[model samples]
Target: MVGIWGFIPHHRVLEEDTILQQQQEFEHSIHKSGSESDVVESIDENTEKNDKEILISKRISSDNEKEHENENNLEVEIQDFDVDYDYVPYKFGEKTYKIREIRDEANRPWWKVFDEFEYRNTKSEAKSYKWYKWFPEGTSSAEKKLLVKLDIFLAFYSFVGYWVKYVDSANLNNAYVSGMKENLGMKGNDLINTQTVFTVGQIVFEIPWIFLLPRIPITYGLTIAELFWAAFTIGTYRVKTVSALQAIRFFVGASEAAYFPCIHFLLGSWYLPHEVGRRGALFYIGQFLGVLTSGLLQSATFKNLSGNGGLEGWRWMFIVDGGISFGVALLAFICIPGTPAKCYSLFLTDDEIRLARRRMKKNGTDVNQSTKALFDLPTWKKAFSTWHVYFLGFINILGFNSNNTSSGSFVLWLKSLKKYDTVMINNLSTVPPALGILYVLIICVGADITRKRFLFVSLSFLLNFIGNTILAVWDVSYGAKWFAFCFGYWSWSQSSVFNPLISDFFRKDTDVRAVAWMAIYIIGLQSSAWIGRLIWPTTASPRFHVGFSTCAAFSIGFAVFIGIAYFFYKNDERRESLENGIYLYNSETGDIPQFVLDHPEFVEKNRYD
Candidate 1:
């Protein structure tokens, strides 16, 4: 028989003499007959004696076998460790297996196995951390330096790209309410039509982006997308008709669609599981900051630059914002690192690149790729069939809906007040986005610390429920409504953590991860745009009771979906443990399971420490 660890199973065969002795004892007992009770007693005593003797002999034999096996294993282990080779022998059950060419030892939680290899020459001391526990563990000095460099070069550009994408998309709304509606003779529903068509464009291009992203380098893809969107944003400055503005918006949306998911996918490729959430949060925060900055920029332009240089304030907003985006696109082309394995950034050294690749490999991430795999039908089928994609997509729809209540309608509410001018309306709109930035940072940091992403996601939904309830049911005062609007933005924090959640769940499969990540936004944004058009119709005005009520209900549903996802995830983990003959525990103090010690890819997913 083959053992579980893929080695020949050891078997002990009984000697012929031992078998004959047992048969003779049984025959003797059967033949002994005296008085009935006496015979029975005699047979019982002989039977007991035979059984005891057999047990004693078996115990002795087992001890001898174990002792011999241990001696052999020890010798093998010593020999394997003494050699400077890629493969190491590991003993499990009655078998020994060879582990080959480990790329990274430090990132694996079971690194102690390698450390204990007696003849290993490398420095294998446990890394010490001076920072908080939330920070990524087992990071070497080289990795720390690399992380700083990646943050400065890669993360910064991702943030900027995301920021500009949002600024360009959001400028339309700011422009519409400020003066674009009047300038282009856009009546009721024209503004909403623009949003709907933009979302349509986004949906149309989502799958194409997903297909192409893996084949092309992310930096080049993102830079090209950014430049295209910037040109469209600049084109918005020349729109003299509603049809022209709609055309410009649609193309802009299509170009900007790649930025979010692509950036997220890039981050997942570069960072460890523990390191991704905070960076993702920072990347997401850029969107809110962009929204906030957009309002401020519009206010400034309206106050100072309106009708100056032969352009209206709204037109000037696009021209200036597009110019800024063009500049960022240029910078991104120069600065953005494609991936840690194939990084072209001036900031990273060859050693750092190797270290980064090693870390990702240990995490079981696919660091290498081929263009042919991009169109693999089986890959897409598996990715689409998983519950992770559909459930997360549904949850994201709710999240998008909840956030839109703040971003879409809150400024409109300010406009409806009539007491505030365009400047005040633009300036006041910044409040929710600013608060959203802080909320996102706090939640994301907490998620990283606790490693409870779904928990935070639930809390965000609950906050949305509360915020929406106030907006839907309460009409006591403007102060209460404004507070509700600001509170509603807190749900935007969910976006920050969602990427990390997806990254962790799909960490083992690159194609699935890429497809699922993009699909979530595609489904969520399209659903929100369509559903939002119905609930927040032109008739609803400032107090869209129907929209708020629907959002509050979805918030509850979102929480329920999160709970369901958690249940399934736990069940899946347990099933994996059972199939592998490994016991699952909530702590990390017991014997390291052979499965984990052998498979570096499962270390992070299985580690409870």
Candidate 2:
């Protein structure tokens, strides 16, 4: 019978070290048995060796085989790092091949064999082996650089796409103030209703898009979605009726739904958990820049092109913005790397892909498996069961209340500023958010470097409370003006760090449904509009104390909620029970299992673990 020694060279080195240690421990056994010489004598006689030469020859052959197997096994291990398997190896017909780790005999350790090569027959074994192979042979140092380049390229592509994203939305507000309703014979809060419809469409599709994103190939899907939204944006410029305008905006919102969530998921796939928030900020900054650029573009184009081609300057704004979106969409198709596994078409090679995959896997995340089902029973329970989900949703609702209003009413508010022209107001209005984006980047970078999130987010909300409070209380005599400007800066700054917190708690690519999350935020935010229209009343503008008071209330509520969550979550981390829905901590020792307190059923059965 063949000895069950290590088969592959690389495997042998690891096993060699293990076996050598085991041999040392068992050395006395070999000497005590007095059978070592007898076994050596048997092998020598069977192989026609002289009695005196038996011991040294056998020892040298065994060592040589072990060394050879070690090198071969190392190569296999490196290649299999990203490929999932449940097997070890065995010998057959002069070749070493992998086999499933499952045992043919009871009481044997399963997973000792590699799962890929598991099979009772040669055909099944061959089929299993196919999955481990990748295109582009052998890993090299050059492949590492290529993967790094791909990461950089993705960053730049995301930046450009993010810049294009909010331009269309910003143009909506710009056009609303620049005679869109009048020119199209629109009336009522039809614009609000249109935005509502657009948001509804977005909510309906966001989750679906995020679920389908990985299967669809982000490079293709995102590029097409961008182009589709661009077409609808330009379509907005062509429409002449309220119904038509509403229809166009609804389509634009629907097409844009999957984008933000998919981008978040994509970034997560490429980055580590701690690394994600800052990259998230980079993409977000592009969005802030887009909003800022829209204002600057509107200021520059509104007058000179007022009647160019018989279309108003606002129409040209839509047209130009759409053109940019289309251009960037095409660029992304060529540049973006979908995932490390299939990134070979770009600069990355097989070895680099493995390295990137290994680094991500070290964080306990399965980087490439289709996470579409993460919303399924157990996982969703794990996610939504946590208080983090509710608090995050509430925090976002607060953000939405501010954002939706700022998106819709800000231009109208700026119309009342008196000192700036329509063009100047548009241009100046974009600055606070642009500056705010800068603050967010700085804060996020610092947060990431420090490996902390709650403090930054809490401090950010506090600043927002102060800024919005100033906006509410000081409405006249440049006090409100300065307040508005400062509020905008602080408001934008908060956004950069706050957005990534959603991903922080969720902590997986599959948990990312940006469109769905946004939809949830919008749904919650709609209440703000409902309450705002009644309490503050549209007529209460310039000094809407009620609106300000409501925002302040929510802001304070968020601070308290976040503080409580941080405490519980931090405790949960210490106990390693964060995964099982235990939020509160032990009072006396601070070491009590939340499962025992909250989930008494689990304790009664004594199976909480």
Candidate 3:
């Protein structure tokens, strides 16, 4: 039912008859006015010259007249507005952002940030390129200020939320290595089993929540999820047995499940194409930062507070981490703008809200506020039947496995060497993630600036292949082992690219987006859960030949997936360039389109070709 991949559907397409009819009517009007001297450019030449900026309906109603009077007067201004491209109207959706005026913003600097931002997955382009690779580009002064506000308000909060999440999630491994294993008398595969239990809880809730996100205000859901995760995380501080640990982790995992798809759906709903990739990387960086923070906190807790609090240092890690989540939950409740259309963040005036929605609309993603749901069974059918869901979902399965979910292996490997103390081990585990942050900063921004997503995506996969290839040949030198672990983190940077890429592919519809992300987790997480328990059992230690080989093969699979995906991406791009203007994907059809309705004289089925 979807249009050709990468084909945006909003651009104007005028058939010759339609053009001739309009031209003839214009000529008659001119004759009646007796202005026979007026110059008339050929419609074909005019259309061909402004083809990229395909004309759109400019009809304005009474209510919108004041708002659009200036917008309608806009002309081609290449420096600020850049090149015009085809626009496709989003056919279905929920949520619309509103804006009241912010008179003070006329003078605000583009680089400075004030207080708030929230929303996700929509595309925004950066027409201007900056020499500085670390920063995002803005097409004009207004957009520059807007990007700054969004970075601070919506994007920053989402980043921190995911960052804090990793703190709680990554702790199980950190806790075990420090002292939990010996203290609790843990047995075989217990480490993997506890994680599996958490994964099980996550998969259990991920489905229903996909339906639930559409029905609920975003902040309300995220606040509850944060609180639930916090409470369960704190509960972990008191657990005494392995069974108790497993039980608490399941609740923690279930509550935490809401964050991923909901945040991503919002992300797609709000951002422009040029902006999402780096912002996604920022959201991802917060995660590694959290992991780094947790390891650092674990090291500090073990050394400074191990015996002072009458609780094990490992236990204290849970309590402090949980306390942080409580603070984040409060922030979410108070400030996280759910969607640009429904946002009421204390930081933004009504003006900024309208601005956010406008950005979305310009990018062809503005949707009517009542269009999606957790159980839109028809939309789900449309979503599942699309080629994107399966292709990207399979790639994510490889990514989920290759992403340093297999990370603590380095920690265990360091442990097996008995070369470092517990504190050093925690510290060492952070190095790869630290390096990962730098990798994403460089690679993602470069990809965003160059607008070559598949190019960088392919490069990351190549790095993943190289890293795992070295590790799989386990009979290597110590230097090789060290290099393999560090190199994998670079590939880990690919997760950021994957996030925006999926958002771009599924950006057209909320219902479809929710279903797509859900399917990915349902498949990806299951693969991760069983794969970790099987190939990466705790018994394998630093020399997990099976684990390394499995990871190596998955990296190769990820590379191959992107190669095939890029072809579709380009093919779709080619389709969008056609003058007939491809049909906006009719999701209701629920299969590869039975026909290309826009092509003249090339009808399908009983129609003449």
- lDDT of each residue in 1-609, candidate 1, tens digit only: 122423221111222224433443443444443233443445456566556556646756765565345434331232222222344455556855443322222334553322211111122211332227644445445567778888887788877877877787778778878998899999877877888778778778887877876667676777888899889888889999999988988898898788777787788889865577788788878888888889999999988999898999999999999999999988887677676534545555544554566567655566644333457676678788878878888888877786554336887887877898998888888898899888888778767655567777788889888888888885758889888888876777877677767776776667667777777777888887788788877557777888888889888898888888877776665444322223333333565655556666423341213
Q: For each candidate, what is the lDDT?
A: 0.69, 0.57, 0.67
Q: Which stretches of candidate 1 lie over 4 Å from their true place?
A: 1-138, 371-373, 405-407, 577-609
Best by lDDT: 1
For residues 1-609, write the lDDT of model 2, one tens digit per residue.
Answer: 112432211111123334343443234334445566554455456653455355455655676587455435433444333322433333435855343222112232354232211122122222332222321233344434544575477767777888887787777777766767678876656666676667766666665653465456677677788888889888788887888888888889888876776666667566664555567677778877887888888877797888999989889999999999889878777666676433413444444455566645533344543433423444445555656656667766665554323434455667776766777778766866667676777666655654456666666667677766666665456656555545544444555445555554454444443333443444554455455454444345445566666666666666677677666655545343222211223334555543345434322121111
Q: What number of backbone clashes does candidate 1 have, counting pairs of residues 3 or more apart or in separate chains?
A: 0
lDDT of 3 at 100: 15
* TM-score of each model, in listed order: 0.75, 0.67, 0.75
Residue 187 CA error for candidate 3 (Å)?
1.5
Give lDDT: candidate 1, residue 567. 74
Q: Which ten residues in a row have the lowest lDDT in candidate 3?
A: 114-123
Work out candidate 1's RMSD over C-alphas: 18.6
